[model samples]
Target: MNKEYTVTDDEVGTRLDVFLSNQPDNPSRSSIQKMITDGAVSVNGQTKRANYKLRLSDNIVMTYQPLQEIEVQPENIPLDILYEDKDIIVINKARGMMVHPATGVYTGTLVNALLYHCHGELSGINGKIRPGIVHRLDKDTSGVMVVAKNDFAHNSLAEQIGSKTAIKEYVALVHGNITEEKGIINANIGRHPVDRKKMAVVTSGGKSATTVFHVLERFKNCTYVKCRLLTGRTHQIRVHMAYIGHPLIGDPKYCNSKNKFNIEGQALHSLNLTLNHPRTNQQMTFTAPIPQDMQNLLNYFRQTI
Candidate 1:
């Protein structure tokens, strides 16, 4: 099916891709740019560059289709629902639960559980495989997460996060006691030059990343710290901590230390998140308690040893 739109006087001077991006249920702006380059978009029966400014009364046609929608089967898995409403649902996701199905793995994920729990009423912008997932926690990271029940809520939440109006904080047990009580790590992060599976702080060709960390408790060897992400990058906390030579204890991907604690995966957890409600425009903060495994590790460090 084709979609057509005529630029109105109020929309004049907007870029072609920008105009399309503002339309309902459109893919990302980058994807829209690609479509324009690929000749899937035309203005007045002729292709135009993505940045071409709009003209009033221009008849625009789009021949591109959105990504195919594949509905994932819902499961009987339970969810730790922290908050729920007609617009959104917040979850205290457990460690070891993947947020959504990926290649070769399709079950036992947050989406599978959400499909059942939300009664298949999740937002479709992210497609059915990740319906309602506004953001994600690593499979081993337990914490508070927000989900959208509809496209309107999804756009609002995504904008809040992307604009940094939403704040994310985490707690982690690192290998060594950070000497400074508080400090900031500012660096560029990108894919590892060699490993490709890991992220590293690079001097070039990387996205700017910043993390503010405060020492919470000092143990014999390890330190418990609170980290606030100023800029969200993939594995920002883990990579920044590792770059500073205090990789998180039990972090399989970033830490090369011995598994001194019986904790599973990383000793990192999302502690708090602050954002505005899409419908009410009211600010809200949600907290997820530290998982038992990470807490037990802390207690063990405090006692006897």
Candidate 2:
């Protein structure tokens, strides 16, 4: 394919690859660099490096071949399906299940299973890599999630979540003694300045995040709580809880405490999800049973107390 772009005054001084990345349906930056290196991209009819800076009214032409599609293979992994219809599928996802494939993880994910089950019925708006995935739960956060079967459902669900009309509730066991029955942790979350991989509660240069938590039970040292997110920032619950001196029992990124409970991952689970049906506009709620690990831990705490 071939296209021509005339640089505008507002876009001056941007790198060649950066400019291409902003284009709709453009290839990855690395791919753009490759195209530039192969003389596929020319500025004013002359080839230039990927780092070439744009100038006002500069005429640029680019030619490239689309990368071949590599389909994600479907796996016959059994899913704990909660509800299924032509429009959506609700599942009680297990802990350790990646919602979609990531770098170096191409199989054994929820996407692969969804591919097999839905059989090409998944929505294509997110592309092949993340077909049907509406929102995601972290790998260790097991619980209720919905997958879209078509584009209409996908758009509706995405809008509801973005507008804060969709309600998602969670259960977690954290290390703390809560005197208050209910509380709200409102903070801004951003990437940790030191550790790029972890999210943190930052005072500035962060997105506003809020978590409303209700104390369900208090152990001698630990507490069981229910949390509802008012804003869906990355690791919002974990970061906010740790900021308030309570971290999920097995959270690897935020908490640095001992794992005496023998929990495999963070003691957090998506307990409830409520949203309106995309087609009927009727309210619907889905629930997932707590994983046995967390349930057993709670039972033991209650029995011993």
Residue pairs in collision within model 2: none
Per-residue lDDT tens digits of candidate 2, residues 137-202? 999999999999999999999999998899999999998797899999989998886554677888
Off by over 4 Å in 1: 1-70
> In order, what lDDT does every prediction score?
0.89, 0.89
Give one digit per residue, the lDDT tens place, for model 1 in 250-279: 998899877877988999999999999999
Per-model TM-score versus the true fold: 0.77, 0.78
Candidate 2: 10-residue stretch with minimal lDDT: 62-71
**Candidate 1: clashing pairs of residues:** none
Error of 1 at 254 (Å): 0.8
| lDDT assessment of candidate 2 | 0.89
**Candidate 2 runs further than 4 Å off:** 1-70
